[model samples]
Structure formats: C-alpha cells, structure tokens
Target chain A: MYPRAFDYLVPRTREEALEVLAERGSEVKVLAGGQSLIPMMKLRFASPTTLVDINRLPGLDAIDAVNGHVRIQALVRHNDIIRSDVVRAENHLMTSTAPWVADPLVRNRGTVCGSVAHHDPEGDWASVMLALGAEVVAESRDGGTRVIPIEDFLVDMFTTALEPTELLTEIRVPRYERGGGNYQKLERKVGDYATVGVATHLELDEAGVITKAGIALTSVYVRNLKVTEAEALLVGRAPSAELFGEAAAIAAAACDPTSDIRGSAEYKRNIVRVFTERSLAESASIAQGS
Target chain B: MEINVTVNGTPHTADVEPRMLLVDFIRSTIGLTGTHIGCDTTSCGVCTVLVDGTPMKTCTMFAVQADGRSLTTVEGLKRNGELHPIQAAFKEAHGLQCGFCTPAMMLVGSALIEENPDPSEEEVRWAISGNLCRCTGYMNIVKAIQLAAQNSTTGGTAE
Candidate 1:
C-alpha cells in the first residue's frame, strides 16, 4: 500500500518549519517520527497534501527535568524515554509506560510527544500525560507558544486543540519529589493496542496524605478520559485499598467502553476497575518507598 | 527526490518518489531481495533492515528518508566472504523451516548480540519480538540467537 503523492518538505530549522506550517496551515502535516503518520498515510486513512518533516530541526529532542517540570521535546522517541536516566529518576509512570509503548522496532522511531499529539484513543501517552497533569506546548509563527493542558489539548479521538498553523514542540510533566505513577494495560498480545489501560499517579505530603491524584483510562472511552471525580476522591485521603477501590469503582463506572473483538463492554469496564485499583496500589507502594 | 544511501558498503545515488517505501527501494531499486516484505503493514518485521545500525521496518519508512544514511541489508551479513555468526548459528540450530523470516530475524539478532555480548533468552526473545517466524516456533530461533551470541568472539562480529 503506497501513500498518495505529497510534497515532502524537510525544513532545515525550527523557524523554517514553523513558517511552512503558517503558510500551508491545514494543508500541511508536521512529520515527526512518522511512525503513526506514515502508517495512516499508507492505509489512505489520511491523505494530507503536504508534509513538513521536522526531523532535521535541531534542539527539539531533549528530555530535561528543569524548573519543576520534566520537559520532553518533540523528537524524543519512546526508546529515548526508556534510555533516559533523567526520565527514570523524575517520572516513574513514563518510565514504566515507555517500554510498553510498542515493540522494540516501533520504539526505535516513535516519539512520545508525537504520540501525545496524535491523540489516538488507544495510544498510551495521553493517558499517562493526563494522569501526570502534563501540559502540551504548541508553537506557532505569530502566536509564539501556547501551553495547553492535556485535557484541553485532547479534544476527541485523533483530535487535538492544536491549531493547524501550530506545531506541538514539547510536553511538560510536573516533577514531584515524593510521587509515583503506574500504567496498567491489558493487551491481547505484545505490540497490540490496549484492551483496557489505566494510568494512575499519586503525590503524597510528608504526612502520608495524598496531596495530588490523577487517574485516567485508555481504550475504555471515546477519548482518553481523566476521571476528575475519582481524582477528587483520592486527594486528601491516605493510601488504602478501600480508598483505591472506591476510586477504581468510580473510574470504571465513569468510563464508557464499547463491545468489540477485544472484549465486551462489561469485561473492559471490569478490567478498568481492576487495573485501576492495582495500578493505584502499585503507585502508592512505590511512592511510599520514596 | 534524489537520495544518496550506502547499502551494504556500496553507495547508491537514486531518484525515488517520496511515496516509495525503503523496502521497495532496497528490493526493487537496489536489487537486494534478501529483505522480504511479509506484511506491508508494520505488523510483520520481515522487511526489517538496519538503518544506521538501528533495526527499522523498511516498509514503514520512505525511501526518501534514507537520504545520506547508511543501511545494512541481509545481503551485507557476510563480513569476510563467509557466513555471519548469526547465519551459521541459525544453520546449526535449525532455526528456520521456510526461511521466509530469516533475513529480518538475523539482522535483529546481530543487532541484539552486538549490544549485549551475552544475552539471556528473555532478552533475545524481547529483541526479536518485533519479528515473526511462522514456519517454526521461536524456540530454535531464540536458541539460534543465543548460540550466535556465544560463538561470536568479538560480540556480534564473527571474524
């Protein structure tokens, strides 16, 4: 399957790429790792007339923990996250989820930020980002930089609030001194999309009380759903199986999954509840260790 | 667009359409047919090749993306006009039956053994997880990779 002929523009610099995006707007698609775009193009599911390959642009591939945020640049691939000591030291959710993004070959090319931008409901990054309260940094020629929260940035399945003339440049995950995050995914097999995925994050105050909480579900909703009610239920409470169970029940009840080959809606929702509880427990345990 | 790529130590300058996949370029343009395309979609890693020493699914990558980059196809496995340690190990362990996925498997295996001189079975399995062997179960393939890792005195290089 070959993609339709399109003008491939490899811009030399970030400014040049931004200029192209400003000129073409919706007509041009920003090509980062091309792991997702190329496949969609080949399937003819997406047929953008032009593609501005941003791979040649410099300084867009750093994973740095600075200013209380772990800044993951656009070009930082999944394997990069797996190999990054900074990520390992700063964010446990991303570290646990990086190796599970896809198979090794796909990881060698697929970027985490690109995955977040793509915003596929089955994609794992957004749920992790949502659970961590990460922010998306979109850059444009005229608007400068607009940092949109992940919840606002992700509009729907394969949809984002990013303007056509804007490019997603970075994802900033807040750094927590005594925090833990975990990604729980149930897939049919290795390299397959998740049947049900739950990302949970917890930040504890020195007094063993939950100061911040994030819980998001993947492949169980029309979009990656952040369970705000459940998160509200977790904050200010101590880490306990009973507390986590209540939050998990709320999350499962909150998500709307459809019946398909992966499983029945009931089964997926049940898995969501179970995985959410397990991930929260695991995360709480890890946080307690710190 | 014109792409300058070094494949198997030989540089080739060619004009290719932006939509032309790297697998098509290697197999059809450069006439190296060792890299098979089992499933055109990224699912099957049969079209796997080392793009600058990184195993990538050529079917998923554009030929134009290979511009000014080096690639290692299955044809380049022979270092000194002899079989690569991976190839010899595959033969020794009877790793293949139909031999459809051999080239991609060996390339992934060589890359794995290169990084880790001694790999556990789990690691070897994980490294080749992207590849699929339909002819036989992965036991022999895993064993073959582990054997190749041990036989190679200088890590992945047989010589």
Candidate 2:
C-alpha cells in the first residue's frame, strides 16, 4: 500500500519545529518515529499535506530525571525505554509493559510519546501513563509550553487535548517511592493488540497497608479506564486475595467492553476481572516484598 | 527530496518522493529485492532491515526519513561471494522452505546475535517474534539461529 504524496519538512531544532507547526499546523502532521502515523497514512486513514519530520531535532530524545520526575523526551523509542536503566529503576511497570507492545523490531522505532499522542484505545502506553499519573508536555509556536495530566491529554479514542499547533515534546512520569507495579495484557497472539489489558501500581506502608493504588484498563472502553473506585477500595487495606477479587469485580463492572471477534462482551469482562485479580495479586506480592 | 543513505557499505544518493517508503526505495530505487514485503502493515516484519544497526520495518518508514542514515539489508550479509554464518546455518538447518520470509529472518537473526552473541532459544524466539513464517513452523528457524550463535565467533556481521 502506498501513502498519498505529501511534502516533508525536516526541522533541525525545537524552535524550528514549532515554527513549522505554527505556520502549517492544521495541514501538517508532526512525524516523530513514524511508527503509527506512517501506517495510518499508508492505509489512507490519514493524509496530511505536510509532514514535519522531527527525527533530526536534537535534545528531544533524552531520558532524564528532573525534579523528581522521570522525563522521557518525545523521541524516546520503546526499545530505549525497555533498555533504560533509569526507567527500570524508577518505574518497573514501564519495563514490563514495553515488551508487550508490537515486537522487538517495531519497538526499536516506536516512540513512547508517539504512542501516547496517537491515543489508540488499545495502546498500552496511555493506560500505563494513567496508572503512573504521568504528565505530557506540549509546546506551541508561540514559545509557550503546557503540561497536561494524562487524564486530560487522552480525551477519547484517537483523540487528545493537543491543539493543531501543539507538538508533544516530552512525557514526565513522577518518580514515586519504590513501589510494585505490573502490566498484564490478554492478546490473542504475540503481536496483537490487547483484548483486555490491566496496569496496576501499588504503594504500601512499612506495615503492609496500601498507601496508594492505581488501576487502569485498556481495550475494554473508548479510553483508558482508570478505576478509581477500585483504587479507593484498595487504599487503607492490607494485601489479600479477597480484597483483590473485590477490587477486580469493581474494575470489571466499570468497563464498557463491546462484543467483537476477540470475544463476546461478557467474556471480555470476565477476562478483565480475572486479569485484574491476577495482576493485583502479583503487584501486591511484589509490594509486600515477598 | 534527495536522500543520501549508505546501504550495505555503499553510499547512494537519489531523489525520491516524500511518501516513498524505505522498502520501496530499496526494492525499486536501489534495485535490491531481498527484503520481501509480506504485510505492508508493521505487524509482519518480513520487510525488516537494519536502520543504523537496529531492525526496523522498512515498509513503515519513509525513504526521506532514512536520509543521512545507514541501512543494512539481507543482500549485505555476504562477503566475498561466501554466505554469512547466519545464511549458512539457515541453509544447513533448513530454516526456510518457501523462502519468502528468509531474508528478513536472516537479518533479524543477525541483529539478535549482534546484540546478544549467546542468546538462548527463548531469546531467539522473542527476537524474531515480529517476523512471521508460514512454513517450517519456526522449529528449524530457531535451530538455525542457535547454530549460527554457536558457529560464529564474532558477532553475526559480514564486513
């Protein structure tokens, strides 16, 4: 399949990128990694008049710890995240989730920020970022930048809060105190998208009481489902099989899964419930230092 | 747009359309057809090539995006008319039957061995997970990669 013809612009600096966006914002698509956009273009689902290739832009690919947040530049590939010692040390969930994405070859070119910006309902990054309470940094042509919470940034399926002139530059995930986190996805095959995916983060006090909890789901709804009700159920509670089961049920009820080829709605909901229980159990065990 | 890329130790500069995919550029423009296009979508890695020594699906990337970069295709895996160890192992172990996915499988296997010289059987499987094969059932493919890992003293690269 061949994508429609378009003008390609390679910006050497961040300011140049923003300037191009400012001028051709509506017609131009910012190509970062091109893992998702190129495919969409080939499928003719997207046909931008111009593609602002930002791959040459310097200083936008660093993974750094800034002011208690692990800041991943927009160009940080999934393979980079998978290999980054900083990511593994600060957020183990990202490490676990990175491999579940397409595959090793695709991961070498797919960017974490690109995945977040694409905002696919079945993408794992949005749910992972939601579970980590991550923030997205967007810069516009006016030399102004804004940080958006993951919840606000991911508005709906294939949609985000970013304006046409805005370029998503970085993603910042808070470096919380060491905690236990896990991402579980039920895909039909190795490289398939998730039928139902769950990401869990748990913080525990020394006495083994849950101090904080994040439970997010993917592929069961139009957007990343953060089950705050289930999260609340886990807080102030000790790790137990019964508690995990209860929270899983709450999370499953919150999902709006649709019947499709992957499975029926009821079956998907059951998978969600079961995966939630299993992931929470694993996360809780890791949290309890077992 | 004109792109200057080095493929298989040879530098080539050509004028190409912005939407021209790297796979098309390699096959049509540069006249190297070893990299097969199984699925234009990124799902199938039969179009996999080494961009800057990392395996990438060429069909999913634009030729303009690969400007001023280095690429390695399956055609580059041989030296002095002799097959590279990975290729030899694949032939000896019968890694491929239909041969549509062999080039990508060999390139991906080369990349895997280059990164981890002693990759286990499970690691080999994971490395080639993206490249799909309808024939051979992947048993011989895995064995070929393991055989290459054992036979090659240095990394699986032909210079």
Per-candidate TM-score, first chain only?
Answer: 0.99, 0.97
Model 1 Cα displacement at B115 (Å)? 1.3
TM-score of each: 0.98, 0.97
| Tens digit of per-residue lDDT, candidate 2, span A1-290 | 98888989999988999998999878988898888899899999999999999999999999988899999999999999988989888887787899999788888988999999999999999999998889999999785999999989999899999989999999999886647889999899887889999999988888889988889999999988999999999999998999999999999999999999999999999999999999998888777773
Residue-level lDDT for A177 in candidate 1: 88
Superposed Cα deviation of residue A90, candidate 2 (Å):
1.0
Q: Each prediction's interface RMSD?
A: 0.7, 0.9
Clashing pairs in 1: none
TM-score of chain A of 1: 0.99
Per-residue alpha-carbon lDDT of candidate 1 for residues A98-145, written as tens digits (9 for 90 to 100): 878878999998899889999999999999999999999999999999
Top lDDT hit: 1
lDDT of each: 0.92, 0.91
The digit string of per-residue lDDT tens for model 2 on B1-159 reads: 888999999999999999888999999999999988988999878999999999999999999988999999999999899899999999889899899999999999999988898899999999999889988469999999988888886544422
Count: clashes, candidate 1 = 0
